[model samples]
Target: MNLPHDDKTCGWYAALPPPQPARRLSGSQRADYAVIGAGFAGLAAARRLAEHEPDARIVLVDAQRVGEGASGRNSGFVIDLPHKFALENPDAQFKQRLLRLNRTAIAQLQSLVDEHGIACQWSHAGKYQGAVGERGLAYLAHFEKLMAALGEPFHAVEGRELAKVLGTTHYSRAVFTSGCYLMQPAALVRGLARSLPENVELLENSAIQRVERDGLGGYVLHGADGQIHTPRLLLGTSIFTREFGYLHNRLLPVMTFASWTAPLNAAQCKRYSGTFDWGLTPADHAGTTVRMTQDRRIIIRNTYKHVPKYGRSVDDSTRESIRAEHRKAFLARFPDLADVPFTHTWGGVYAISRNFTNFFGQLEDGVFASACDNGVGAAWGTISGTLLADRAVGATSSLLDDIHAVTGMPSLNPPEPFLGIGVRTRIRLAAWNSRAEV
Candidate 1:
């Protein structure tokens, strides 16, 4: 089975102080429930399970450190609505229900942050979707219309106003929405792991190499140094779920690369006229995602590659090529800060489904899973895991119904070579079509 391996170059993780030493699982252990992958989904599932059954011992395990995976490697946008669902389906009811689910996830995360005093640089400063050229402007226009139809509030900005806010004239138009929150993703995930309930035991750097039936209607997870026996298993392993003998072709694991510049000096900061902390997503899907971080650093993320093999690492040449791409995008936005060098560059995996739906249901009689989040894993992953625990424990709520309504089964992907070829072709076409936006 494939296991997660970190490159240790993620800007968010590198920015934080060194984490405590990881505790690996050893010897034979038994728990009432075992949660795999200590990311947003796994952490939330383990915490919620503990809340439901305080006396039950729950084991939460990850292949790497808690904050060194995709959860920490993300761009850190806690989006409260669909990125572009309105354009394709235009189903107001579906969008509204999804909004409620996303908001609930955000609220739950906020409550935890406040209660635990997690200093993750949590910001309510909102987000901007910017357009650089005609294609991007068209997308921005559609987004505005959708927001208007849904009665969602948004403010449109362009020309001088847009330049003033973004500190860049590369974008010709933009839209601001109040519901999104930005934060240090690595810090947030680490905080969540630290704040897990007392009954939950976290085991890090303990990759589960194999899983099998323990005969008596339970499962046995074989890790490097030890094994876990449990009556129930919940997998939040994202794309790695296929290694556990589930999901199969239902998930497309794509790797996206990002780079963050060294914190700007005082003079460079003066040249950057934007707000202290703000995030801007491209209006076009393939455009670059840029953020001005709280610590005065600039981040640029773009480029995608399909990786059927979950643990394959990017080659040195490809990494260098991606870094050049990031540098080009950074220069396009901030030519004045030409001396600002990128301090970190890294890639992370996020699973996408063929039909853009997530997998969140029973894998078998005793195994439950929540995989594909389609790139909005922060809020979506959190809520799905929370509700999955509720479902596993036979608890019911309207929120659970909403998750079911929005997320059906992920459509099956074509087998092997065809799947890889098709995904790469689609990505190339998108990048070509949005070349100006990049």
Candidate 2:
């Protein structure tokens, strides 16, 4: 349950300019407030706390450099729609409320980007949810029904339009929603870290070992290099919250893989003959997510693995297998561009729940925690982190209440071997069922 130290070999990280060397925690430190995990959630929480208490000494700590974890590893879609397979919530109003929350997060992010002039390739180009075969079409149809009930307008695109939007003729059915935006996640994280308020201390490359309360005072956050004593602490590490036994089996680690093709040359782009800068999510929950980067690179994310406790990254064999699957999926969607090969491939962890609900709230006195993005980490993490900060200071809002009711405590997972077996079996079955989409 240690915070991840492995590189995870994320293509997103390597594709960007080299990050500045991380400043590790040195000697001893004390803070008025401390947040563990510098991903979206933790960063948002720390930023919010600083806003509310500007003069307070605030510390934001991460296991790796900013944007190196799930925050930076995500597909970079700030989706207004809910996460995949997240409609299990019976309260219909919650869906609309969640959508509002998502938009709020997006607005806040945009404000930061504009105010700081962050160079994260932030785009409002929207996204396409495209379906190639009949199965994917069915899923799209279901989404249409849901969107219609919510009174949301979604433009259905197909034939030449789909081809032009997605850079391929594989999609016979597709819909474009204006709610989502795309970006280079690594850049966004680094930009966020750089833009943080001067009072908020940002600590990176500090793997937290454990948290223990001092006998007569505040909490002691023991890390690899040093210790931090703080009166207030927030846990935003998400999947690794299991280390503190706060979330326990309420969340499970689900790893997803993505491969980025080498940027297509001008001739290659012409031969592909589709849009060069666009992003698309799969119509099916288990289908592949594709993004045609502004740089003319095609990235495909398709496989999911329930990485074990001791490991967060996929092994070489799994990587090879997914590489083949990526190529197959890529070719199916873009047979004409078969020669364009992927330049980078990697996997990142997501915390899914047994019942598909994410969680948020206080764990103990002076300790607040938020996790379980369900599947959409970018927006969900941002909103949850902001909400957690409010909760920490006893502030109340309608959005915070909605998060509380919507994310109710996660369902208990089955015991170890059985839980792992059940999750793996379900993933395999679901992947096989969605083979056409994947």
Question: Which residue pairs clash within candidate 1?
Answer: none
Clashing pairs in 2: none
In model 1, the Cα lDDT at residue 367 comes to 94
Please give, for residues 1-438, the per-residue lDDT of candidate 2 as tens digits. 555744466777887788778788977999999999998899899999999999999999987889878888888788988665655355678887888889999999999999999988899988899887899999999888877777788989989877776777888888889989899998898898899998899999888888998875579999877999998999888888888868786888888888989889877878887776688888887899999888888999988988865243556887889888899999988888888988777778878888787778988889888888877888888899999999998899999878887777888998989998999999999899988888
Worst 10 residues of 1 by lDDT: 81-90
Model 2 misplaced regions, further than 4 Å:
5-8, 310-313
Candidate lDDT (C-alpha), each: 0.90, 0.85
Task: Note the clash tally of each candidate.
Answer: 0, 0
